[model samples]
Target: DLAAAPGVGVDRPRSPQPLVTAAPRADLVIWAPPDVAAALRPRAEDFGRTRGVSVTVESVSDVRSALQDVTAPESGPDVFLGPHTWLGEMEQQRVISRVTLSRNQQRRLAPKALAGARYDGQLWGVPYAIANLALVRNTDLAPQAPQTYEQLIANGRRLKAEGKVNRILLQSTGSTGDVYSGYPYLRAYGGGIFAKTPNGQYSPGRLVLDSPASLEGARRLAELGREGVIQPDVDNTNAVPLFGDRHGAYLVTGAWSVPVIQASGVPYAISPLPALPRGGKPVPLLDVDLFYVSATAQSPKLAQEFVRDCATRRDVQVRLARATGLPPALTAAYRDVAARDHHYAAWFDAGRDGDPVPSVPAMQAVWGPLGQAFADIVAGKDPQHSLTAAARQISSDLP
Candidate 1:
C-alpha cells in the first residue's frame, strides 16, 4: 500500500526548486482530454503572448497512461490537465512537482478548490473547475422537488404504481457497482469510506467501511435492492437515456449529464438531494479538474507561469467551465458563470455541501472492494457479511 510504503503519504514538503527566469526557449506542451483540449486550443496562444513562448494543446485519450509517461525523460507533455485524484499517486511516483501559489493567487481560489489541489500537506496543482452530483428531477413528471428522501421514494413509488414512470430513481450502480454514484445513498445511512480527522481531512490511518454505521448503510442498500429501487442492471450507459425518456423520475448525476438532458428536451430541475428521514445527509463527492506541472519539464518555471497566471485568470476559467459544463474553481470566475447559468450555480452549491473525494494513494485500495461490497448487497448477499469482508480485504490490501 502506498500509504504505508515509505515516502507516499508522508507530510514531507520538498522545496519547489523554482527555476530562474530565463528567455523562453522550447515550446511548452500541455496534454488534456479531447474536450478540454478543444476549449484550450483557441486560448493557447494567449497564454504565451507575453512570455515569448508558444503553447501547444494536445488531445490525449487516456490521462492515466499519459501521466505514467511523465516519468520517462522527454516522452510526455510538460503539463498534464487532469483530475485532482491523481495528486497522491503522481506525487508518490515523483512524476509531478508542487505548485507554488502566491498568497494573493491562493486567496482568489475557493477554499475547497485550493484544498483539493493539495495532497500530503502541499499544493501540487492549479485547479480550474469543480464537479459534483445533484438530484436531477424531470419537472414535468415530479412537478415539485421532494422535500425529503421519504417523499422522493414515496412519490416515485406512487408514480410507478400509476404507470407514470417505470423506475423509482435513475442512479447508476451497474453490474460492478459504482461507489461514486451510489455514495449519496450510502451517506444517507451514515456510511462513509474513510474517517475524517477533527480538521476535516481524510485520515488514511482510519478505514470506516465496516463500522456499525456503515453496516447499517449496507443494510439500507440491500433494502433498496430488495424493493427494486436501485438495480444492478442500470448503469451510466443507460441511466441518462432512461431518465431522459421519462422512464425514471429522478437522476442522481453530475453536470456531464446536462448536455444529454438538454438534447432530450426534458424540463428538468437540479437541486441537492433531499434530507434523509433517519439522520444522515446525502452529500455527494466533489471532483476537481486541475493542471499539474511535470517534474521533468524542460521549462518548469514557464509551465508554472502559464498555470498560475494565464489559466487561473477569471476569463480563462469561466470559458473552461462553460465548455466543460462544470463550475469554475476561481471564486470570481464561479460568480461570473453562476450569474449566467443557474444550472452551474446548482452544481456549485452541491459541491460546497459535499466532501472532496479522498486523494490519498490509500484511496486506491477502497474503490474495488467497497464497490464489490455494494454490488453484493444489491445482489441479495447479507449486508453485514459483505461489508465486513470488504473492510477486511481493504485492510489486508493496505500497507
Candidate 2:
C-alpha cells in the first residue's frame, strides 16, 4: 500500500522547458474518446485563432492503451482526456506530466474536481466532469421513484405481476460480479471496501471490506439475489435492451445511459440512488474525468494554457456537457445547465453526494476478490462467509 501522503499541493514538474511561442501554424494535438472528440473539433478553429496555434482534435479508442504507446517526447498528443483513476499507473509509467494550477485557476471550478485531479501531492490534470450511478425511473410506467431499494424491488414485483413489465430494476452485472455496480449498496449498508485518510482521500493500506457495515451490505446483496430481485444473467449488454424495450421500470445506471434512454422514447426522471431500508444513504463511487497534459509535449507551456482553457472556460465546458449528456465539472455550469435540465442536475447532485474511490496501486488488488465476493453474494452464497474470505484475501494482497 502507498504511504499516506500530504494533501494535494506538492511534487512540481521537473522538466527543463525552453521558452517557445506557439507558431502561427503550429499544431496543438489532443486525443479523446469519440464523443469528446466530436465536442472539441468544433471549437478547434476558435481556440486556434485565440492562441495562435492550429488545433487538431483526434478521436482514439481505448485511450488508456494508446496513452501507453506515446512515451516518446516528440510524437504524442500534447493533451489526453480520460478517467482520473488512471493517475497511479500512468504516473508510474511516466506517461503523463504534472500540472500546477494557480489559486485563481482552482477557484474557477469546484473543489471536488481539484481533489480528484490530485495524485501523490501534485495535480496531473484538470477535472471537468464527475460521474456517479443513480436511479432513472420511467415515470410513465412507474409514476413515482422509490426512495428505498425495497420499495424499488416491490414496485418491480408488482409491475411483473400486472403483466406490464418483465423486471423491476436492471443493474448491469455478470456471473463474475460488478464491484462498480454494487458499490452504492455496499456503502449504504455501512461497509466500504476502503477507508479514507484524514485528508479525506482514499487510504489504500486500510482495508475495511469485512467491517460490520460491509457484512450487512453483503447480507442485503444475498437477500436480493435469494429473493429473485437481481438476476445473475443481466450484464451491461442486456441491461440496456431490457430497459430500452420498457420491460424494466427503473435502471440503476450512470449519466452515460441518458442518451440511449432518451432515444428509446421512454419518459424518464433521474433520482438520487435509493438508500437501504436499514438507514443507509446510497453513496455510489464517484468517477471524475480529467484533461491531462502529456509528458511528451513539444510545447509544455502551450499545453498548460490549453489545459487551463479546457478547465475554466464556461462555453467549452457547457458545450461538452451538452454533447456528453453528463454534468459539467464547473459548479457554475452545474447551476447554469441544471436550471434548464433537471436530469443533468440530479446527476450532478448525486456526484456531489458520492465518495471517491482511491487512485492508488493497492486498489488494484481489491477489485478481483471484491467483485467475486459480490458475485457470490448475489449467487446465493453465504454473505458472511464469502465476505470474510474475500476480506482476508484483500488484506493479504495489500502491498
Give the 10-residue window scoring lowest on summed lDDT in candidate 2: 6-15
TM-score of 1: 0.90
Minimal lDDT window, size 10, model 1: 6-15
Residue 36 in model 1: lDDT: 78
Candidate 2 Cα misplacement greater than 4 A, ranges: 1-26
> What lDDT would candidate 2 get against the real structure?
0.75
**Per-residue accuracy of model 2 over 1-399 as CA lDDT, tens digit each:** 222222111111112322222334257877777777778777755777887778777677556656555546565678888877778867886778998778887887777777878887788898878777888888978788788888898888988999988876787657767777777778886679778778777777787788888887778778888887887887666776678899899887778877678889988888888778768887877767899998878777878888876556787788788877778888788777888888788887766767766777666677778777888888899988888898889888876
lDDT of 1 by residue, 1-399 (tens): 222222111111122222221234338878777767778867777777767778777777665554554445566667878778777877888878888889999999988888899886789999998878888999988889887878889999999999999999888777777777656766666668889878777888788888787777677778888889888888767888898899989998888788889999999999887776577577778878899998888778888888888778888888899888888999999999889889888888776777778888887777777777888888889988887898889888874
Q: Report the number of backbone clashes for model 1.
A: 0
The clash count for each model shown is: 0, 4
